[model samples]
Target: MAKPKLPIPVTLLTGYLGSGKTTLINHVLSNQEGYKCAVIVNDIGEVNIDAELIQKTGVVTQKDDNLVPLSNGCICCTLKVDLINQIAELVKSGKFDYILIEASGICEPLPIAQSIAVLEGDEEEGTPAICRLDNIVTVVDALRMATEFGCGDNLLKDDVDEEDIESLVIQQIEFCSTIILNKVDMVNEEQLGRVKAMIKTLQPKAKIIEANYGKVSVGDILNTNLYNFEETAGSAGWAQAYDKDEDERNEHHDHDEDEHEHHHHHDEDKHEHHHHHHHDGEDHSNCDHEHGHCCHHHHHGDDDEEYGIGTFVYHSRRPFNQEKLQEFVNNWPKGVVRAKGILWFSDKDKRDYLYVFEQAGVQITATENGKWLAAFPKSEQKKYFKEYPDIEEHWDEKYGDREIKLVFIGQHMDKPNIIERLDNCLDD
Candidate 1:
């Protein structure tokens, strides 16, 4: 009756080119805060170059320090064949407490997940997994999402063929468990709102964190232990991957009822339990691909077409009635697959602190963030605004960055009503 040993967290960082994956990697390595961390650069040539840059931060080099560079970095080269073996080698080294796998810009991240998915499951609850897949963090450049990764509102634009790189970008967004909307500073408010809305349509299940230059709190990305095999495999492109496998493992049992019950699973299921929206659990049992169902995975064909979806942004300087805000969050109207930003409450206790808001579904939870810049004296304001100049755009000389700014996305969202409801909550 031995308890399973804790599985070390293995985080996979995926993003398109110039999406700030390396920056985030550098940040993690530079500010490891004494964690015996190991960085595994799986991309072909980028790892060497990126490693050099990371070393420039004055952190010891992995070659002489804490990094491991792997070959076959090209997408065309060997992929799944030796990836697991390489991971096993790192695990055996026993030199690190946490391991980070950075996916090349071109490679699909799901295959990387399945390579580890075989290890996580409730059936193996008593037996520790080789490594727990902590999170599939995708660093999306907000500016690029609009200009480069033209992901419209549609999650499955299967009717239209897609170009190679464009499709890959969309797939990466859809497959992640948490998405870092990096490079937020590069875009204007209008562009930022559109990009967030587009992302919501593409991957409503992924928890979105608005980040600038990958300057996200380390606690948000690593060691959170929020990865759930059953729940995570619900994104549009990778939904039902593990569940389909689980059903096969239990063939003798009557999985038919359970299968049918969730066969038409909606986005609400994924968000109901957590922020990320769930996909329809349609059975692709007929898929014959060697690596589970291939229907949802993108092949990135030549005829990629842009999706046409709506986006809405609400920026208000007034503080909200705490009761009204909470009530609206509890029973908000349908739609708004993704809603996230900062909230300002009128209540004395709540007003002093910035309330961080992120929602995958109807359920929205507001947690206390650090104080608003307005709370600090004018002389000390530069220290706060130095990192986020964008905050200064909306900063009131008297109020500072104290406002309820939320970006919401849905199918032809009732933007006006949503705006009105929020405005109604404001104190006179």
Candidate 2:
């Protein structure tokens, strides 16, 4: 006889460095109901604030403590084996109904998920039941995310890569079902709008919540099932809008790209062409991109300097020239801190395409695009391709794929110059 499968909901709490993940988890543990919770807090250095906070919740702890701590700090690659063993022990004890794993700020959730996805009954003893992943709620520092798009100061290591920080933040947000934008009190009303808009651009499906010192409701952050593999690959806001079924959306995006390209060319003719266009929009009267002064009124640089943080979207209908794009990416200007989005290159060996996120002048790999053959199951592909067949007869005939889409974030940089360099890389 086999044991019944239990609904073991596991919530993953994660965020960037100094984003107050521990503080949010402490509040969850204190306010949880209708479940016996087992928390596994993975800490990087000496401080285990999440573990300490959960322990103070007066829940029953297994011997050697239920809080499995991985002090080595590389959870993305090395912590899976220990995590599986601890989960097995806890399930066997039958003392917990739900589980929560507080991932280290720098860790990626893919490997941890892969470990849980492969769990089997033979590896365990008493309770050999299937465990389900529930919610992944990311806690964000509103103030920090406003000023710093992706890069963070690493006080621990001397040579910390800023590229790694951007990649990690994007990965965490992409996989999570909900994102909690904590530390709201530190930012003003205008700043809050900017943060929300930025987050909406990065992750459209996520439900963003504002909190100060972990004041968010635990119920809202839990129980969401948002872990589909295909959707996760194209989960960003811009990507989602680009991925819809309607031909009208595609045409609209294409028209938008054409308009943007026209503007880029017009701006190149004379710098005064974009003199009045604000960073957010043209409607705001006080804003001006010509002077490098934003309406946020943060007082960035001196009178002679132009230093304000901003983001913009770039879209292309054709693939890039690989060598030219590489040169452009490597030689980014000084004020530009981060630029990320998907790119299609004609010279790349891999057909699936690539995702690039540049931070502090380093480009880090996010993932390869979805496989053309795997897009639809064999049975469905036969039926679907009949109506909308690819006339190009591509190597992978069934799936339709196209060009570069990027989002640029910079501080006090010349937008016209940036757009010009990037446009030269794309095939005309």
Candidate 3:
């Protein structure tokens, strides 16, 4: 039996508009770093502007077979099927050692990653087995990071629908494995430090690289092997906060159980003893999210607080009053940079669906994700219960697994006040 052919590695490049993605693509394609590379460029319209720009640089030619341009729509949404098909064709050719995809500026990285992940010879579409996603690299506009983050700007284009620039920017940053802080020369050291700190709070797992003119070593961006679907999926700072809180809770629970057993064996002792857990004066490590009422805060460091950057996770099982939730989002507290999570609404028509709530800058949206397990018949819910027995622990007689789990990351976050506002939005 012959060994299976290894999948060709592909690097995905994503960033906000004017973040110098085109310059970086040119750099990667021109340098190559001993690997034969094929470039797939996605642009907003029929013009294929980025590809043309790269072509003008003389690194790649328009007539070159290696340059494949995907235009007229964002790859993450409208052009997803085309993206998979293109990858299949590129892998089938076997002419390139590496493939690079430049996602449109307004696109989200998660969908692109999901599309590639599902192509492991499982779906009806004849996706080639010889393609593997290597890394997701997000380019950041260092000079603009400080100015545009909470400026309430929209990425509007003649060819594409308007999108919240701030939210899209943070989303791109949160889901990437490697972040290129491009155009660093344009910002002073203090400004750059703040930007780096902000990125750290948003995505602690991503590696940060400073660059000028979108220039970075091909070695740093290509074939780094940093893309792990599970890890990257939960790599956002908010997700990490929830994971840390759960871990601490489990540890505390075990400690309590051990203490209980010890007390049972020593009931005769008249002296009262208490086990106190000290946090070294930092209260950020505590998990307060219980019964949909806890706010889990993150401790980045002293400088983090000085910069007013903080992260908190809000968890609740209660469904939100749709009108109240909307009002709260519209009047979100100052210093909120980004907020995203699964939400449950009390509207009768919307009760069956789980909404994905997101707020970036001044823009907020709640889109239907899918039906909640509680909306399904008991027989249908049994399969999920068998697969994940822990689901029963969070299941409510009325709501099942439907809950509100949101994470907010920003500067000077009023965690207690935010929690109160969110609680007010919940249906009693």
Winner by lDDT: 3
Each model's lDDT comes to: 0.59, 0.56, 0.75
In model 3, the runs with Cα more than 4 Å from the true position are: 1-6, 118-128, 151-160, 253-292, 346-354, 367-403
lDDT of 2 by residue, 322-413 (tens): 77876875675655544555555665464344444334324434355443332335575455446445312221222243445565554566
Error of 2 at 320 (Å): 4.3
> Model 3, poorest ten-residue lDDT window?
258-267
Per-residue lDDT, model 2, residue 168, is 69
The TM-score ranking, best first, is 3, 2, 1
Tens-place lDDT per residue, model 3, 1-428, is: 23225588889999987899999998887788778788899997889989888778776664767788999998998999999988878777767778899998888998898888765554567755667888999999998886666544444445445555677788899888999999999888778778888898888889999999888888888889998877787777766665665555455643321110110111121211222222112545333334445556766776576687877777776889999987886687988888777777888898878777777776788888678777878787787678766555446665566777787888877888888898889995
- Return the clash pairs for model 2, or none: none
- Residue 365's C-alpha lDDT in candidate 1? 69
* Residue pair clashes in candidate 3: 288-294, 289-294, 292-316, 308-411, 308-412
In candidate 1, what are the lDDT values of residues 105-185, reduced to their tens digit?
766776777776655535646754667888889888788666644323332233223325555666677677889999888
User: Top TM-score: which candidate number?
Assistant: 3
As a TM-score, model 2 comes out at 0.66
Higher-ranked by lDDT: 1 or 3: 3
Ranking by lDDT: 3, 1, 2
